[model samples]
Target chain A: MAKILDGKEVAAALKDELVAEVDRLRKQGITPGLCLVMAGSRPDSQSYINSAVKRCSSIGIDCRVKKLPEDVTQGDFLKIIDDLNTDPKINGIMVMRPLPQYISENTIKYKISPEKDVDCLNPINVSKVISGDDDGFAPCTPAAVIEILDYYGIKVEGKRTVVIGRSMVVGRPLAMMLLARNATVTICHTRTRNLAEETKKGEILIAAAGKAKMVTKDMVSNGAVVIDVGINFDESGKMCGDVDFDSVCPIASSITPVPGGVGAVTSTVLAKHVIEALKLQKGIY
Target chain B: MAKILDGKEVAAALKDELVAEVDRLRKQGITPGLCLVMAGSRPDSQSYINSAVKRCSSIGIDCRVKKLPEDVTQGDFLKIIDDLNTDPKINGIMVMRPLPQYISENTIKYKISPEKDVDCLNPINVSKVISGDDDGFAPCTPAAVIEILDYYGIKVEGKRTVVIGRSMVVGRPLAMMLLARNATVTICHTRTRNLAEETKKGEILIAAAGKAKMVTKDMVSNGAVVIDVGINFDESGKMCGDVDFDSVCPIASSITPVPGGVGAVTSTVLAKHVIEALKLQKGIY
Candidate 1:
């Protein structure tokens, strides 16, 4: 069996560090806060919100969830985002996925101020990431990927990294982040032909395809490190990732499991970002 | 010898098309105008300006040149850009290269309005490009690279493209552009170990390392299409590129020359952007 790049263990460690940081900031009368806006009610959204709120409470960070109806107007949503932007107590702002069909992500993205956009969904932050400017914070998922690598003491510098999927949220941003760390990064997608030929080249393989078992054992090189970012369901209705974990584990040097890997890290990262956003708000590095 | 991509011929064809477009726009009382801001007496800067000016004159677009002293203050230079932004006649703003060591490119890039940023140097345009929003123009060299590929009727969808170098000016932007086109792009740099191993993976190889003959025959696969973006000096003081032309020419299915490959398309692309910026200002696609 390969060494598990344990996100549960790592996230616990990060949360402890954030706890100390939040406590120290509390001494200066600073209250770290996060504002989450969820448009429409979905069970998945509620579950994520519940978990996030629990995590925030554990870290002493205030979590505010604002739920809007499905038929909310675009202007109203923008107004709400603007309100959070100017809210001194709100250090970070995150809008849950699948916002109403009528409300475009671009419109919401542009409205979020870069500083409060802890999710880094804003175009300005995206450009800063591409330009390799350290001033901007990376989107939490990609940031978590880097943190996971760092925790495992993996050699990112000069390593061949292949990123599956090219969504703005994961693959594209992650490629830029990996490149900034001096990794030779390649971005592949659904449109990519001969996927196995490309995946075999990665010393570090990242799968974010959002499809179950997209990367099989043959797709990876021997002892290659795999980071699975996929969250999907198998035909048996069980949660799985893009990588065939059972098959890949024996061939891979290290691999992250779907439930125990990235999912474990994300909430902790969001909490850490809230603290960081607080520090920035208080003019502390 | 390899079949030359013949960028000079391609560029002439593109320029001729732009000339006709300029005439059509003029009839609608929308004359494309470019504002060239040169902050020093650098020979390279002077030569580039002269070339752009002559090209614009031939194509029926009005070109304005603002030659500021090398010792000009940042405030004064920004003021000149502001003036151009407000000037209805000036549709495109271009800050010529190496703006006196004292004046940073960031300052100039920020001062130019996004609407008039023909060079696509501003953060706004940069962000737009990364976000896949068609509102802004792309950087000239990167845009030209795409144009050349399109002119040759080469399909980028699902192809393996290796971009050697990650300079914000070319490599990074070009990589994003290629990704948007559905090409699996790998970006490499000096820190990249086993550089040749990475280069051999490319169906389309873009050499932008700015080093003469850095990419040798061994680094390239047989029949790979090579686009050399490097303009550097050889040991014998000859203008060359990252790709070792003599040895790799026989191996490449199609290749571009140092002077005529990417460089040939750059200025014409800039001219095209100027026109495009003008159209944008008039609220026309």
Candidate 2:
């Protein structure tokens, strides 16, 4: 049986480290504050916002949720963002995505200041991440994945890694991070032919396709380290991962379970980015 | 035998099209000046600079070569770039690489104005290319490859592309561009295991690995389109590409020869970006 790479444990340790960093900021008369901008009452975004608030409390940071009406005009929304951008207390701002259908996402993304853009909604940070710019913050989900690998003492250099997604949040940035660490990363997406053939080559396989048990036993290489970043429900409406957890776990050397894996790890990393964003404001970088 | 993808013909045609665009800019009283920054006496950089100057003249744009001493301080170099960034007449700027060992490349990159960063030595533009930002310029070498594919009517959508390098100038950016066009692009670098196995899967194989004749006949799949971007010298001091052209030519459907391939195409695209940069200055974009 493969060993479980527990993200919850790693996240806790990471938070403990960040807590001290936050404490330092508190003593310096600067509170690391995250302004969560929510536009509509989407349950998906609400769930994430709720988790973010809890993390803020645990880490001794401030969380202020600014709720906007679903029917808010583009001008008003942009004006609100402009206010937050200049707010001395707000160190970082995250606009909860899939805003009101009428509000342009691009306009809102452009409106946020790059220094306060903790989640990488701005185009410049998104591009900077892959270009390997140190100033840019890593997208939280991808940063969480890296944290997991480091926690497990997995060597990334010269390894063959296969990332099974092309998402802005996870796969692409994660691949860039891996490539920066000298791993040969192959990014396979929905259009990739012979998925099994591709996955079989990976020493590190990252399943982030958001499908239920899409990666089966036969697709994995022996002793492969599998990281499941997918969150979905199986046929019985049970929460599951993109990996066929039960079957692939026996074959893989190291594996991360769906609920207790990357999902559990992201918020802490998100909070860490907020703290880093705060430091940026202080000109520490 | 594979058909030769004539980059010289494509580049010539592309320049012809740009001439009209440049004419319009001239009519608007914007000459689209390019400032080519040369530090020290690197023969390789000088050779590239000569071509860039020639292309500027042919396209009716202004070219100025600013030479700096090999031992120039970091402050002086950055000041020069700062001056170029604000120079109203200078539309685009490209700094020849391999400055004095003491000077940091990244510093010079960040100092250049993004509007005049036509070569994309700057990290932000490199990232913007993949981030779906239409405002940023694609690095000339990668843009030239795309232009060649477009000239030949080779569709990128849904094609299986394998790029054999991870350099900022070509492989990484080209993969992003191809992915943006709906192609499933796999980037294989030096650390890739079973290199032949990976390359064989691609419908379009791009050889950018700088090693001379690194991609052999066995590495390519039959009827695949091969793009050789590697510029290297063979045992006899003759210029050669990564692909073993003679052996792979029969197996591939179409191929680009070395020296005359990407090299012939890059300068013209570089000139086009200057015109585009000028347009941005005029608020035409």
Interface RMSD of each: 0.9, 2.4
lDDT of 1 at A13: 86
Write down the worst ten-residue block by lDDT for model 2 chain A. A123-132
What is the fnat value (0 to 1) for candidate 1?
A: 0.89
What digit string (tens of lDDT, one per residue) describes model 1 on residues A232-278? 89999999989999999999999999888988888889998888877
What's model 2's overall lDDT?
0.88
lDDT per residue for candidate 1 within B189-250, as digits (tens), equals 99999999899989999999988899999999998999999988888988898899999999
- DockQ score for model 1, please? 0.85
Candidate 2 residues A1-285, lDDT tens each? 889999899999999999999888788887898999998899879999999899877999899999988999899999999999999999889888878988998778768998999988886687678767778887788989999999989988878889998888788788888888878787888887777888898999999998999999999999999999998998898989999999999999999998999889998988998999988888975
Q: Considering chain A alone, report the TM-score of candidate 1 relative to the true chain A.
A: 0.98
In model 2, which regions exceed 4 Å deviation?
Answer: A23-31, A73-76, A79-83, A86-88, A217-223, A233-238, A244-247, A280-285, B23-31, B73-83, B86-88, B101-104, B283-285
lDDT (tens digit, per residue) of candidate 2 on B137-242: 9999899999999999999776778999988878888888888777777788888777898899889999999999999999999999999998899999999899
Candidate 2 is scored at a TM of 0.89
lDDT (C-alpha) at residue B53 in model 2: 96
TM-score of each: 0.97, 0.89
